[model samples]
Target: MIRLPIKFLGLLLFFLLNVGSVSAQYKQTVLNKTQLLLNKENTIPLGRLDALKIAVVTPDAQKYGVFVQQLGRYADISSFGFSKYDEQTKYFNTIIVAGTEGDLSQEMLYMLRQSLINRKNIILCRFQEVGKNIPQWAPLLGGRITELAYPDFSDLAQQNMAMSIFGGLAITEGKAINRTEQIRLQYTRGEGSGLNIAKMTQKIDFIANEAVREKAAPGMVIMAVKNGQVIFEKAYGSHTYEQTVSTKITDIFDLASVSKIMGTTPVIMQLQEKGIIDLDSTMGHYLWQAKESNKANITLRSVLLHEAGFTPYIPFYRYLKPGDVQSKASTSHQTKMADNAYLVNHYYRDVMWPEMLKSAVKPIGNYVYSDISMYVMKEVAEHETATPMDEYVQQILYRPIGMKTAGYNPRTHFDKDRIIPTEHDTSFRKVLLEGYVHDQGAAMAGGVAGHAGLFSTANDLAIYGQLLLNRGEYGGMRYFKSETVDMFTSKQSKTSRRGLGFDRADPDPKKEYPSRLSNSTVFGHTGYTGTCIWIDPKHQLTFIFLSNRVHPQVSVKLYDLNVRSRVLDAIYETINEVK
Candidate 1:
């Protein structure tokens, strides 16, 4: 017998291993139109108009042919990098992929996320068929592989998994539907064919309860709202360690930077609605420059989006007490003043801040978040309303919306003992920031600047969220038209994931998932004092987490806790589909 060469046998073994790996990988492919399964067994009965329009990616052409025949008029095959447009160049509602694995790369997932950001829906079918070891940056898919052990289910399992993992929103038969447990089971029902909703519910319950048990945040109230209703509302920790000041669902907070959302932006919207202020109107149109520069051309939106180019931050307190000599604590980044100093040692009241705004050298291309923009906007808002910014907001926006606790300059409507303190001033203005505004620049502007210094409670803030969802109208009071509201909340710049003053989550959740509801329509803002508010119009969801992390001292590290995101993810998963 002729013996085969040892090297040839070794080569054959290597090829077999590679083939097996590829075959496993091949389970996830770009399905063609012919392979989509749309028969009565897999797809719900639908009229011609109701049939889903789907884009499938798979490597098996023959299987695709069979799938297309099985699922009549439901699926279309597309190349790997297909444009997200209909035959008429309009947007397509859904893209059906064979699974999360196979030909899809991190870049492709990124592109898919971009399409979703532009409001396109995505359907990842047979997702578990995709092997494990997926990249982290692929939002839904990455979370799926890491969180779920790639379970395969009958049609019911797939549908239920779609709902839970996607924040109770799922792609079914090519349509994006909100939370409803009464999902019509289109697949064969038997043991192992459907997701154990009971198990998923238990896991969700643990996380929500953990959010309350951990009690990591003090003086905080975190909640998630869907369709203007509270889905998950809980208070973790307390308002004060002493327990004298406690946090309540309706307890007021010093919204700090969040006031930008409640105080100034609403007034801007009203002005826009009244044709009083145009987004493109230049800052030079409002405030007279103390000095000269190209910043006069910056628009109102640029300031809100932090593109007006002032500076990240400055020690406005230094100008408050200039004559007093002081050394700040090393931990303070030398950002504060001596405890003994007063307003005499500073020049910020009228000079340093105004000079920086006037001397903003760059011409508005670089990203720099500045309080000066809000101050300037406040000046313009006052000029436009022929009233103070606070009064204008109260009369036209806050009062009408029933936001009793929201304000910039709180002349009288607050209790100091019940309020949270922000910082101990040691650089220039040597005083503990308490009931008054904590932002130095806003303090210099007399505690009523547009960018910061608004006090509020969660309930009042929820009303603000509801207003945006209502398209700027609430309780018959019209704050802005739906178009104007959309313009304010929609993405404004490439770099700034921000609309007028709203901050959106990174399109790819893995880079940083801001909230559980990943829908691109969601928008909100964060306060320097550990506060966040997010609104998702798609599911009508809202999440508000308020904490005084800045208490005792200011540290920016609390943002990575994963407590807020994890708790929110659990609450979203808790949503049930109505039959």
Candidate 2:
């Protein structure tokens, strides 16, 4: 307006653009003390209370004790009845007084005052109304009390602020208590503010109905997590056409190729961190037989990125003849030949390794997804560590993170009822595959292979997803250095758009696997048995879809159904709509 010089105007424009970018990156909300106390903040830090002990005090200690236990999953938390207020204040660093049912006892009030004097943080929740004057702890709690005609009628005018706590739990709006009881808080701003729970529910419901109507599958389990919190999780349809048993959140599903990432990949990452394996090192470094083969020059990085020239797969199980029925001899090498059992005639390492080494290697520098690459990598990892892949991953990764249901050979640890059936194998095995692995190759590998044969529940997968989002730390323990995580997740090749062991967001928007709304930083993998794990680091989002789409038969293509991608699209659209 003042006819400023052209250079000055350009500088001003650049400054404005930079400001906008910063605002987009860190969207902070202004809220009053009361709002801050009631609402958790967005982008909550991980491992917030790792070093400190917390005690949750409530009048109904038994009732709120359940919430405390859930919070313990992420933090170290203990429950204490009001009677133990004095003792808790003496030991714990922070004390949370929840519920508004009863009047404050003088001893508890005195202890809170002393805690304030000691500069100890105290979180108070007035969830209900009591017939008494406002307690003196109101000022300490960063809020002023105003008498109302009804105790339950919270003033909406004062609810203009929001805060997030416990990593992705958000408290937003003018005191709108939406999904308040749930510990995981979701924010209400920009795209996050407009998340349509109703529409999301409807979408999954429709897909489940269509799947059943079209005989795609009898049941499905969908779990979506944003910022280390589960936003949507549901089980649809019955176990089979018979409608005998209903699917549950606790039920574990066959993960198929997802095993590559969740099982083998993590172990490899750990080995790299321990200086036991190098991505650039040749496969021949670990497998002595590969030292002389064409694969001798192939690097672990190339194999993981799927550019190692290995063929997609080999049906080695087809070569095995029917074992002697009379020889009921079962050892580590073989399973008892039964009607509903896998016929493992010999040790996989002795028989399969030789065959794998003999397999032809195609021309290098091409993007060809190959299960054989993972199979070889599995052998390499096991040989280098002197541990079986399954046992190593269990002890080093799964058990440490409390992923109880995540492991190979589910029949060993879980009950049959807890494991979902994958298929009725009529081709090779000729039996109903329940707790056993569905992949013929993995079944022949004694139910533990790199490309397939891992079972997990939605909740456990969410925990693992959160671990990655946290940059490989969970429950106050550091599993992988942040740099290692970044290295593995970074795009490795422009031509393939693949990470070390993870698949990045498709550059082509038209690709049906990742949602179009997903930014380029999102990385994940989809299993052949209707399982997928997509993580969007930019938005701190993770989505897991586990289903036995091949229950009766493995004919239905999930891509044609657009079930997974559409759900992802819907999630992003809902988040972005408010903006």
Candidate 3:
């Protein structure tokens, strides 16, 4: 599937308060997919093919070299070969045949035609350093087949053009695939959005200004999408009171507990889809270590709902004796905790896990917001998938959704400045927590945990909100099934305001995590580090907020100011005013 940020806070001050690219003149008649058939097209015979096939009609794969490289950024290319005499090559969903009529024998041409007849998407690309109109196989391919001037654009732009041409229909070959577009969402800016932009803007400005003025936090990013179109987005304040740097819209922030939904829960949902983990099954069904402990009888559904009565948190760092500290990672202590701190190897396994299993409370069937729930669930997922949670979710969710900056341990993949500072770390690892995780437990676990340790920009989180809002599909790709999304995002427990793994709007409207304006249909999670991801299905909206409210020093100013929920209420009011 192929398709197609900054902020100024001084701009609005009204009712409610809170908060959180382009290339080219080239155009293609693009759809979500070719055969899922967005616009009218004749029937296509569906195949089990998933990956792209670069069918080089010329003897050398050299002709399609640059184009194939561009395609690689969009989708994984499984095989490349000459299409001559190979009827089996048609099994692939998308095929790019690079040859003019001159290079094709009658047999190769026949194979290409058979592929088209078999409903395979074939791209007739004329390899060129500069753009030219060589209508090579346009007639045969039945789509606009202009060879783009490679020099006029970037590799990313070239990939966008290819994606626009190939479309989203082919990726249906795989369950849970990426609809790789360089741009993830479409923005409308309140035009025809039913919301009152002027009033909304004024309130938004008030929220930002108040947050900064009240000293709750120096900076924040707020973004809202309504009816599938981004209606409002803004960034405000500086990275800290020092004001040495202004926070850009592209900056990624520490997403504390939001990691539960952003990573762990998604893995559990996907694993459930594969029949790897059963929600109703006991914890012992998956993790052998839990078998001999009190956790063995706990149900995964209870764990997700926070009704398993797990401990709210365990201060694993405090338990660390002086001997547990290491100047650096080693054979015995291989986990890096922070910029200059490392932890003993198998600390979580040998220490944390045993403590969790032996804890007095097992499954009390009562809601208790517990970090241990996510920790255990993360292990359960790793145990089932045989892959680390980070790697597994990256393969299945973030990468596929066209999310640019999402995953654990931002330091490994991004520049330090690109990741906003979470805190000055007055205690524990007494250093500025920039590019390192803010949660001590997750940092102790080496920056990959079920509950916290994720870091991402607002846009990446928005894509996830859109993923759930569209009922497990986005940009024409499906991740979880509609039912899976419903079960995970809808109310699942009578004892708590929780879906399977998501935090729902509080049943008692006054105490909603987001706002009293929110209904039960809203489902998402909040990060302790002043970040949130809220998606509403009934209203067709997704709201995201990211802030390092703990920067310099931990303070409750953001909550005391009601910055997030007020902005959310402003959105609802704006929409309601128009309606």
Candidate 4:
């Protein structure tokens, strides 16, 4: 027996006392409600079944470790150790037994055999069965979760088994099987969606494949919903040029500039809805830090409208002095940039913000697309809400919508492989950027910027898009009023095709921006990393295209070849087809 240190045991015992009672109650509640739903015959799925209703058993030493202590942040799960199995075996339809080869007790092995005989969902990983009492079929339940660790273990066998048993289990080829939920859009398929289903999907697939062949991107995930039904949702190709790991529908992509609309704008609108700050008021009234500079006088409306007279972009990375970039954080350099890179502390407040504040404002407002404005707006969000933009959005918006994998600083929540590679930065932080923000300015701000640095899978992001399509309401929860969504998504700028922190189709007759078929009523924003989301209230459509066109290096092939617009046109043509 590997005797755990006494210090570890003390913490473990403390956890069992404080954390065990609640876990036991939670487990029993799940046990009672779940017995009837485990079968594959129920018609009602979300009768408020707790997704967090999970039972976890770790080696005693690891109970207080990162694996268990940190797993619940990303998922709504309730998990505990092995002591309850004998008392609850009759109640459990599934269980995960995780340990090394020598750690499985004969008693645990015996229970495993019994559960296998009971036809339960059994997952055995990183361990080998011992003793003659175990069944031969038990070995077949074995597998490995090598890619997951620490905080990301919420996707462990528990989520997969939960997904399978709780309304998602399937009987295929006479054998019970569990699968990660794909095709997550709830209302989908049928004659009522009004489309030539087969032809529309075939054309969309061809467009995506051609985009890959031309290297517009290595891979892509495309999803489109019309009239509240998912018309198409599919993932194509691999994560990179090497094609080693084929992209899954659940993979998250860096939302680059799209973060302005998806991450920052919603919060601003909600603040307005609560009457915390008037949209029409000058930001100078609220930002005391910028009182002496030109930025203080710009209106919040102009900032969101991208007409705040700021420059298009500033290359802050090019001006880095010695000691500015450090391999590890120190008292003076406390901001982390990437896996090994950290930025000097207060660089934003003392250096970047001062430069932005002093930068000459163009003659009032002629409509310049600037990241500088959103950079200040992030400060405004933090200043007004007294909360970090990342945490504020997560607690107020994402967690409520079940957007499990949507947020800034994705590496903190997911494995690198789970996030698609954005680019290889030859300019600054010279590592291949995976699970890191691709935008240099945002990265310097510790990967949480108003203009960039948000990531999410197509499914989770689509929920946000669907919220706008439904006029600020989704899944029986209302995040914003109908008037609030209307004000933000509608055209709010006079000289440009910009909504409140959103992008719209150009009204000019000479330009074919976004799609030739798109009307002026649709609103969305495109990311620099080959991703976009377009929501159309007129047609009740929400389209999302996520890719990594900058994987090896920066390229505009996604636009040069008109991949997004062409693919979008096909859907419109198919939907309007006469049968």
Candidate 5:
């Protein structure tokens, strides 16, 4: 075993003795009472737990290293060394971080707040002598944290004593799982601040207007928020062709690609947080089966970000058996392609696996948005979580957030007659697609593949939309975390307009998106079936629009863009601005 350098240990002891007393709040508990040893200045107090050896990171090391050294003892902290000091990855749960007053880096303080997203246990301590101008760590922390600006070391000790008592109380009586009482105590008793909801709303309105003008549909919903509360919420257009069927505050809509934003992405995040999987793990690692050498190194991150370089769309529903085909079939041979039941069934079973045997193109070259990426993700998620995708989402998100209306093939949860139909696929099954998956590939896979299967209304989508706003926390429960949301939503290097499957700002105006949005903070997605959800976190707003654009003909891209634009403009106009 490697030993810690003795000189470093000596320096640490010197600092402990010279740095004056740590707080008496950390009592000198007796370990047989024989270990009591007061420092020369009678300033330091020691305890058995304190005696527990800790690896000291020198001041010369990176700042996060220092912060980790100081804070790690109070909680579990782990780190992966990066090539550069600034790029270090430190794992933190919600452990409050306190530091020498005014002495901490603002960025480091922000990191402390962000650590709370996946990890719920966090604490912040303050140094007696640091000054003001502390970094705004609230957003990362998910709320304003209690600041302990003690007048002296003695006061610091007393304050910690009081905090410890409160912390103990919080642990023992944690006002039921759904109760906000404990949080109220944390706010009132602890010096805490909340997220700026007003600002969140404003940003959303701006983005919604952009998406509305860019990708017009019949109806829309826009919302924005931070820390699990509504920043802004509004709806545009009718829910159905019948004008009387207005969209309710809670009406559910098919999320479409937004479903990935809700389903696969979040599930992957949770798996990472639970230590069950690594983001960088090769697809082969989780699936335990390699598709091909070219695809071997493709990670979950690559697939989620659409960097796996697969084809964009595949016409899977084109398969049919003889007379089962619609006369719309361009050729008798094309009709024959659909009628062979063996070919169609075999295609479903084999599409996702044996990646190496298919096309010779490597997975590393460029970004391509393939529905199959989600399909592969579905397999990885199920294998890792040991549960079906629907059940996994239900257990981890839907049930907790009260998204009772969200699911794949939502025939049981939604009213069949009221649900909007997407297409009349004469090519495959020759049936109207409603109350089931619109994507033929996902339908062939039991309507539960990673892509294009989930059915939710705008209202149900809003719950998830709001959950994203909160950075994975919603209602009274912690879902994922703010940091994970940031990672997934922030633009990746390969695409400016795409963060995983979510939308983002781009310089190219002609690129896909509602044309009105011209900023980076806005993120959203549109469905091939004329459904969309856009959110502006900067403004705390979200706009969801759902339409049966395929009613007469499956105009995959046909819609009156003006109607969506008008609604988007109206929502923006109604935005409430609060200083």
Candidate 6:
């Protein structure tokens, strides 16, 4: 066994104790700020609002939307303009009134009074005067705002106050603000240790050689994060066999099936917490088509678990042929063929939805790994929330967690060179898939589908995995309750080792993937385009592997080489050796 130096252990303990004290002090400061704003007469403590629903009320929502939206990153928040307030607005536990230049209308004042009478918490920004007499609501706000000479109205002051409201969370300046101190605490508490880099390097080199010999992938990028710290991140070989361009750590890859978990699953979890979605609720509750079809009885839980009786996938794109003309018409899906050549096509969703609704339902209770299930669930989620799936997930989850490189339809926002090419397709569009989704169904759906369309860098994926390891909390933001995370990640069915939207560690020792070193509590998912994210809460470990294994052409040779499984095994072996 590899023994850690005694001095290192002592230092680790000392650092953890100091960090704990510091964290407590920070919490106290935030509490004090809350008390100061809510006044001494307010009996309801600020802690009550921790898990409560919050909304930002503003007279001019568009003007102050960005500020409130920034706060939404650290808290679950909904926004409404002064004119939009209604009976539904009363449901919010905490209503924050962002200052506006105009005076508050009588209707607005009535709503504020009603909220106070309902015992709802209120936070007021002193940027503007709300009414002639400040004494009426001044007691609720602790004090009245008085005009002073030469006030320091700087970005730093705004950020500091926002941080206080969010319980001392540092907002994203230019880069991600990682909770490295918490990671250190988890590490020192025996959750994980620094990786055995030399051993892992040797193993990766051997694996790369094997992959080359077997003609698997020309290159690979692997990153392993343990207890929030990136222990190992490296790139290998060239972009492709034909192209000699060296791969970099920032290169994005087609995530394929990984999109199910990364792009769609977290959104479902968030919606569930907001009481907008229920796992046990039927699909018909959200989708109109499903309500009239035999799928009316299918529950959202079964859909997420892949037991919803949907087929694996349908070649929906096959119905639409590429047009010979290259025009920038808004009606057609324009795809880049070459430097100037393009393929313009349109998806016949009118026919597709009817056909899907009339399709016969298969018997439930068995796990049949289906992509169509996620596609249907995506539509249901979108319809229920009245927000596009891509936009909703990005706003609530990805942006908040600081996943800079994760999103769908990458070509619109990211440069082509940063996005690694996937395959040279001869059968479908007859174009090299660069900055385009490789999945035909998602591509036909305008490159925004639940099953397979997301592209992200290893760094962003690592941040997401770390968020899961932290039990759905990151950067002082609670995205989901710990119980909610556990509910989704825990095994749901006996026949299949499937969590709600995650693939659980196989109980059987003979199962492939999710290395034998992982405990039963571990859950993760893999993508068709050589990407995988495995998180082990038992060990506080997160492993991410990204590669263009299908570059130049799609092949199963990479899986035959078992490169990912071997690398994962090596990682665990190193961890065990250290322990």
Comparing 1 and 4 by lDDT, which wins?
Answer: 4
Give residue 129's error in model 4 in angstroms: 38
Candidate 1 per-residue lDDT over residues 1-579, each given as its tens digit: 989899999978754532211100001111111112222122222211112344443334353343333232112323333343333213354454433344345565666566556554454444343333543233554332112212342333444443222222212322123211211111111123123335544654465345334443445777654444444454555565455666666565667778777788888877877898887888777766621556777787788788887766666545433333333434322223223323322344346656667554456756677766676677678777789888777777665444556675443566665566655555445566666666766665556677787877676677677667767655334667876777778777877667787677777866556764565676788887777787777655567877776655565445545655665565555543331
| lDDT tens readout by residue for model 6, 1-579 | 988899999977754532211111111111111112233233221232334677777677665655575555344578887776766577887776655334455566667666767777666544432244543344533333111111122333333334435433322221122111221111111213445667777887788668855668877788886655456778877678865688787789899999988888888888888898888999888887778898898998888988878877677656654463343443553654333334455442564556666666788877989887888778877887889899988888776555667898888898988888888877666778887888877776667888888999887787677677767666556777865777677777767989888887787788755786777767889998888998877666788888888988988987887888888888888889867
The segments of candidate 6 whose C-alpha lies over 4 angstroms from its true place after superposition are: 1-180, 183-195, 321-348
Native-vs-model 4 lDDT?
0.69
- Selected candidate, larger TM-score, 3 vs 6: 3
Candidate 1 clashes: the total is 32
Structural similarity to truth (TM-score) of each candidate: 0.58, 0.71, 0.73, 0.72, 0.56, 0.67
Tens-digit per-residue lDDT, 423-498, candidate 3: 8876687778889899999998889999999999887788788777766776556788876887787777777768
Model 4 CA deviation exceeding 4 Å by range: 1-184, 187-194, 329-331
For model 1 the local lDDT of residue 45 reads 20
Q: Which stretches in model 1 have alpha-carbon errors above 4 Å?
A: 1-216, 322-349, 409-411, 424-432, 576-579
State how far residue 455 of model 4 sits from its true place (Å). 0.5
What are the lDDT scores of the predictions, listed in order?
A: 0.54, 0.68, 0.70, 0.69, 0.50, 0.67
lDDT of 4 by residue, 1-579 (tens): 899999999978754532211100000101111111122222112222222233445556353344343223223444445677656555555454455444556777676666667765554432222234533333333421111111113233233223223222221211133212211233234234446879988888888999899999999999887655566888998999899999888899999999999899988989999998887888788888678787777789988888888888988999999989987878987787776788898787788878887788886667888998789788888998899999999877887666778999988888988999988887788778888899998888888999999999987777788777766665445778876877777777778878889898878745766788887777899999999998776666788999999988998888888898888888878866854
Best-fitting candidate, scored by lDDT: 3
Off by over 4 Å in 5: 1-251, 291-293, 319-347, 351-357, 360-365, 507-518, 556-566, 573-579
Among all windows of 10 consecutive residues in model 6, the one with the lowest summed lDDT is: 23-32
Best by TM-score: 3
User: Model 1, residue 377: what's the lDDT?
Assistant: 74
Q: What is the lDDT, from 0 to 100, of the residue 45 in candidate 3?
A: 21
Clashing residue pairs, candidate 2?
40-163, 40-164, 41-163, 41-164, 159-174, 159-175, 169-185, 170-185, 191-575
Q: Each candidate: RMSD to true structure?
A: 22.0, 8.6, 11.8, 15.8, 19.7, 13.3
